[model samples]
Target: MRVLLIGEYNRSHFFLKEGLQELGHEVTVIGLNDGFKKVAVDISLDQNYTSGIKKKIKVLLHKLFNIDLHSKSIKKQILKNQSQLKGYDIVQFINESSFLCTPKIECEIFDLIKSWNNKVFLLSCGTDYISIKYAYDKIPKYSLLTPYFEGKGSKNNYQAPLKYLQEDFKKLHKHIYKNIAGVIASDLDYHLPLKNHPKYLGLAPNPVKILPPNPIKEIKGKIIIFHGINLYNYYKKGNDIFEKALEILQKKHKNNISIITVKNIPYNEYIKSFDAAHILLDQVYSYDQGFNALEAMAKGKVVFTGAETEWLSLHNLKEDTVAINAIPDPQQIAKKLEWLILNPDKIIAISNKAQEHVIKNHNYIKSAHKYIDLWNSAN
Candidate 1:
């Protein structure tokens, strides 16, 4: 199979590309570096409108004409690479807005891709029309939208996901579902909302490249807790909740625990920055681990993120055995942190289980085959 993954999400497509290559499939990934994380791609769709005079004009254009220079620049990049993008056996979009364009533009690009590709699929991995509507409707017990529902849905912080609610984006959503051969979710957060759709192909757990478990670093001196925040997603990802919990822990266990916090760093630096940490505080409002959280778990760090009932049932695991289920309460999170601080043995046990969990459920090769099976079935 010659497969083309159309976007990058936390290196999800790159890892999948590696696995497909291992399986003797020719795969190409074409997308941005996923913002500041700078994940690699075979073809770059970078828009150089970020700083200096270009940025000022971008803002001025938007203010005067409601025009997004990003949308225009990305479309031009697609045209420049249109030749390389043709003739794939399978072409999968990483999200509904794969090119991060307006709905009309996305539809145009969809038409272009469909004209050249044999089959097109959609991966409901990031915030999209269906998942956001489902979450805003309160379908899940809790989701990334929980904070938004609680009066924190600021236009500035949540503009990306909120745009899905508009009529233009709604039209784009329908057009995608009508054209794509099938849609597959990367994890349970996305899976639950699309479970009953006729074209839904079930969940393929997010693929993480599983390497030999790094020897569990001995917790020397004080327990290190790492929290990396992206300001744009701080509210949407429930980072505020994590920060509040950390505050309580810092004061309560000041002598026994050391806290490290960072904001909006590159992906390479963000991942490497947590190497010495004993525990990683991931987001508080997900039904499953996001890409960063899963990567942290694969590194054998006890992650404080979603290991909810749905996830536990899916994997048939006990609570707090693999990763701690982080609820949206500071007191509760602090309690969980206190327990881990007092029980270093529990942290080690969970760390070991975390690595094992990723090995069994999220190995890149296994995940790639899962995608291949679904693609074949759809065909």
Candidate 2:
């Protein structure tokens, strides 16, 4: 079978494609190639920074129009590859999300597929349309809103007050979720909310190909914290609170803890830094699991993040596996670290469990097989 994956060839993309091939299928990926070990057909979506005096104007135009101005160009590229697309058995969108921070245009290619009677599977690898809807509706009056999805119910941008806008947004969510085919959720919290619907097929968080167990070295005193920011976008990766916690930690444990901030490293060398750290911190507000947490787990490191009820119920975890629960109070965080310092045995025990969790449930081979099963079923 020939499969076409639409998304940037990142770590997750390569692993998925690799998994598919291991199952004896031919997989070809589209988008900016990161030069990973995957069969890639390079096609630039022409996504770039628009500058000049009109930077604000271009951003405003894109935000207000809610349609990617480059959609036409991307459409042309897709048309040029139409012949190749026909040769494939399935066309799967890895993220399929056109809108990252702005409103995304509905791919004209989906309509083209309608003409060919071809099947397409959209991957739940990007922004949650539902969460975006919730956030959009919660905006105060005179606030800007941009809807990313398409059709009559689609919302991209609007300037409306909180009360009126929320009512409008809530009404739209029920309809869109009901009409969509399915969603793959890595976070159990994300999955459970959509379970009332029939098409919600559960896919685990991004899988990591586990490395051989490295001998545990004494890393209790060494701690590294990761942080990032986007001025135009809301920060999800929990750098702010972590900073606050760090401030409190510094005053208390002055020279005892070492903090490191990692920003925009290349994918291949991304995991290399984890070798030096004992614990990884994840997003604070998000009850969802992200790529960083999963990769750290694969490396047998303890990852700490928020524990939502939905996730606890899904995994039946009394305490987080390899992840210490994130608490707002600096005292709480300090206490956990203190416990780690005093009890290496406990940390080792949890690390063993964490490694087992990733190996058994989130390995690339297992996740890849599940993805192939879904693709076969979808066809």
Candidate 3:
């Protein structure tokens, strides 16, 4: 089978491509570098002219005349690449608004792709109108929108959810959901909201390349806990909570624990810097783990991330023995950190379980087969 996976989220399509190829299927991916993460793709759609003076001018034009120069550029790029995008056995969009442009432009691109292939699946890997609406309306406790509901909506992270609630995004979401072959969730966060849809497919774990188990490093001195922060998503990812907890933990066990926080670094450098850390602090707002947490877990690192009951139930896991379930409470997070600091033996044990879990559940080959089954069934 030949598959065309469109858009990139944390190098997901890249890993899926690798797995599909290994399973004797041809796959091609087209996506942007996705900012500093620098995810690889076969056909790069990154707009080089959207920065500096050009960006300022574009913003001004959009403000004054309602002209979206960025969307115009993306539309042109899609038209130019239309020929190469066709003839695939299946095409999977990363989200409803996969092209990162206006909804109208996304519909245009989707119409073109749909005309070429009928088996197009939408992956619920990130925020979308349906999921955002569900989150805001249902207001699930300790979700990504928890901060927004709890009177901490000063950050820009809520902007996307707000925009998704608008009419234009609603139209796009309805159009795509109604026309697509099916929708699949990459985790419990997306799956829970999408599971009842008529065209909903089953959940597929995010694909991660399994690395050889690294020898457990002895905690000779201070334990190293690493947290990478993206300034734009700081509040959304609950970095402030993590930092506050870190400060408390540091004050209590200054000599025993060493906390390293890096802000807004490139993906390569970010991964390299955290390679030797004893534990990685990932997001606290999510109900399911994101790509960063899974990658860190794949490296045999004890990751403090979302392992909520919903996720546990989805995976049929009986206990919270894998990753630590991080909530929005700083005191609870500090307690987890303090416990890890005191019980060094448990860190090694959890690290081993983390790697084993990733290998068994999220390996690229196994995930690729799941995708194959979904696509075939949809067809």
Q: In order, how many clashes per candidate?
A: 1, 7, 0
Candidate 2 residues lying further than 4 Å off, grouped into runs, are 8-10, 32-44, 49-68, 99-104, 113-117, 134-181, 215-217, 220-234, 327-331, 377-379
Looking at candidate 1, what is the lDDT of residue 187? 88
Alpha-carbon lDDT of model 3? 0.85
The candidate with the higher TM-score, 1 or 2, is 1
lDDT of 1 by residue, 1-379 (tens): 8898998988999999998999999999998878877888999888778889998999999899999898888888888888999999999999989877778888888888889889999999899999999988998888877887788847677778889999999999999999999999998889988988999988998999987897364566899999989888998778899888988988889999988999999888998999889899988888899899989999999999988999999999999999999998999999999999999988888999999999999999999999999998895
- Give one digit per residue, the lDDT tens place, for model 3 in 21-118: 99898888988767777768898886745689989988898899988888888878877988888888889999887777888888888888888875
Candidate of highest lDDT: 1
Q: Write down the RMSD of candidate 1 (Cα, Å).
A: 1.2
Instruction: Rank candidates by TM-score, best first.
Output: 1, 3, 2
Sorted by lDDT (best first), the order is 1, 3, 2
| Model 1 misplacement above 4 A | 215-217
RMSD of each: 1.2, 6.8, 1.4
Two-way TM-score contest, 2 vs 3, winner: 3
Q: lDDT for each of the candidates?
A: 0.89, 0.55, 0.85
Candidate 2 vs candidate 3: which has greater lDDT?
3
